[model samples]
Target: MTNKLTVKIWRGKEQGDFVSYEVPRLASQTVLDVVTYVQRNLEPSLGYRFACRVGMCGSCAMTVNGVARWTCRTHVSKVVGEGQLEIAPLANLPVVKDLVTDMSEFFDKWARAKGSFKGKRTRADDFEPVKPDSRERKAADAGVECIGCGVCYASCDVVSSRPDYLGPAALNRAWTLVNDVRDTQQRERLRAVAGDAGCHACHTQGSCTVHCPKQISPTAGIAGLKRVVGRAAVRGRL
Candidate 1:
């Protein structure tokens, strides 16, 4: 373990600077560990947000070493170079504080994309048997594990350029539902994600897929939506 390490962290809201902090490096320390050390020991006033330290929560995502990643799962030894690191809040969103970004817009885009599942079943009805091997189920399965970490949203260049864009994550969520056999909102979901602010806006830069810590390809999902919605529009369902 290196006894000392230099960490440069973004230390302001929408208009601030990255401040450097010298930290004692420990064996197998993750980037979140380094930020915690600084917040606890060096600067109590520093701001960041996290819940579960494990990768499941997806709350500790930040731009570390010029890449958007889940800091809790990002090991310092793997990402750090030349004994220095740069950490900042997720890009393409309004910064709340130091390393904390405002996620309201990101989550709100999910609503705009009609990402919610509209179930057709009632409690009195029999259980719906969905085969895991079925094509729709399998397609939905591919993107169901997103933890809403905003990594894809932050990495997307489209979101940076177009504020009204529904973003990859939200469009991805809509894709999952569009493939669900039990979801009754297929036509509505397609309509919601069909227009300019929806899946059509994706340039397919693939930054979202590259930065997703969960390995979910939001780019692929958004592409799927475009195809499905395009067909619907051609079929006059729009």
Candidate 2:
């Protein structure tokens, strides 16, 4: 293989185009490495975001070859097609510049879903014991490992067409809180996530689950929310 790779990186704001650059191809080359090389060598003005070059921090997520992924974990050899690569900001969000998308809307939807835990306990209250083996705890634990990465949000088509739709991450977060036994806002949260702009909007195509670097099933979480909402409506609690 030649020691050079042609990478088309998106530049500028919402109204930008992909600017191609030739980067060195090395062993164990990652997409992040290519971007870094371009930023350090080819272009000094390029913009992107990355932290914790390992897979733990999802700040490196971007559209690689039309698929949302963590650039830190994506190897050049695996995703490069025809000796070329296309890197852009995550989809379904406003691009601030180049590969950096404005995540304010994504987090706003999380707040709209009432993803925060609202409990009756105060700092002086005794620690609430939650058995890991219990069904409720298990359900809450299923979706709690989210890193707030925008990959799932960008992969969701519902968010693309309907900007008001709470994306997968927000709904998954709400599902976790809904299952929290110690939370006092279950009824209100269920109502918040029940309408067309919430869990009801998910088409269940499983794209979020497929592209999640953490192997999380936001689809499962959304489905659980649906069931919980249905039960609440039946019980006149919604």
Candidate 3:
């Protein structure tokens, strides 16, 4: 391990390039720590986004050496190669500036996939009893922990190939809702995720599953969506 690391950081919006800087290496340093040092000590004008540096927020994700990762949890010793680091905004999204990529499109796709749960119960209705061990509940439990991190979206190769694709995170959310017995919009949600730009568009390359920091298998969710949608299509319900 060297005393200094060559840090090359993206310096502008979508049209800019990488700018090099020398950052003093420290013990147990994370990639976010390195970026913070550059912004605070070397270049005060540098722009980036981070909250809850402990990795709970999932807002500190960025592309490091061509791979999307949570910078806060990425140790410097693990990523530094030849005492060098390359940091940039997450891919497949519009860059706001420096390490901040515009997340509007990512969330927009979530909406398009009907990611939100719609229930039939009103405020005055009695509480619905749900069994934790039921199959539906088990399926829902498999994917209910998504944090909207966008790491899977950034790592999905299908999104890069087909810009209109709804992407993995949105489809994953829809899958969870599909298994929610309380959710009244299963048919509509299935319709939303079924067409050319939806679940069928996924080639199942599994990059989204491979890169998700949360270990959420979006590929599995997509496969479930495919089975549901295919059944609906066969029955002329889709």
In terms of TM-score, the best-performing candidate is: 2
Write out the backbone clash pairs for model 3: none
Looking at model 1, residue 108 earns an lDDT score of 95
Superior candidate under lDDT, 1 versus 2: 2
Q: What is the C-alpha lDDT profile of model 3 across 1-238, one tens digit per residue?
A: 5688899999989899999999999999999999999999999999998999997889999999989999999999998888899999999999989999999999999999999988889999998888999988988888888898889999988999899999999999999999989999888898999979999999999999998888889999999999999999999987
75 Cα displacement, candidate 3 (Å): 0.4
Candidate 2 regions off by >4 Å? none
TM-score of each: 0.97, 0.98, 0.97
Give the true-structure RMSD of model 2: 1.0
Q: lDDT per residue, candidate 2, 86-191, as tens digits?
A: 9999999999999999999999999999989989989999989888898988988888999999999999988889999999999999999988889999878999
Name the lDDT value of residue 30 in candidate 3.
Answer: 97
Model 2 vs. true fold: TM: 0.98
Worst 10 residues of 1 by lDDT: 112-121
Evaluate model 2: give its lDDT: 0.93
lDDT (tens digit, per residue) of candidate 1 on 1-238 = 5579999999889999989999998999999999999999999999998899999999999999888999999999999999999999999989999999999999998998888878878999998999989999989999999989999988988988999999988998999999989888788888899888999899999998887888999888988988998888899987
TM-score: the better of candidates 2 and 3: 2
Q: Which of candidates 1 and 2 reaches a greater TM-score?
A: 2
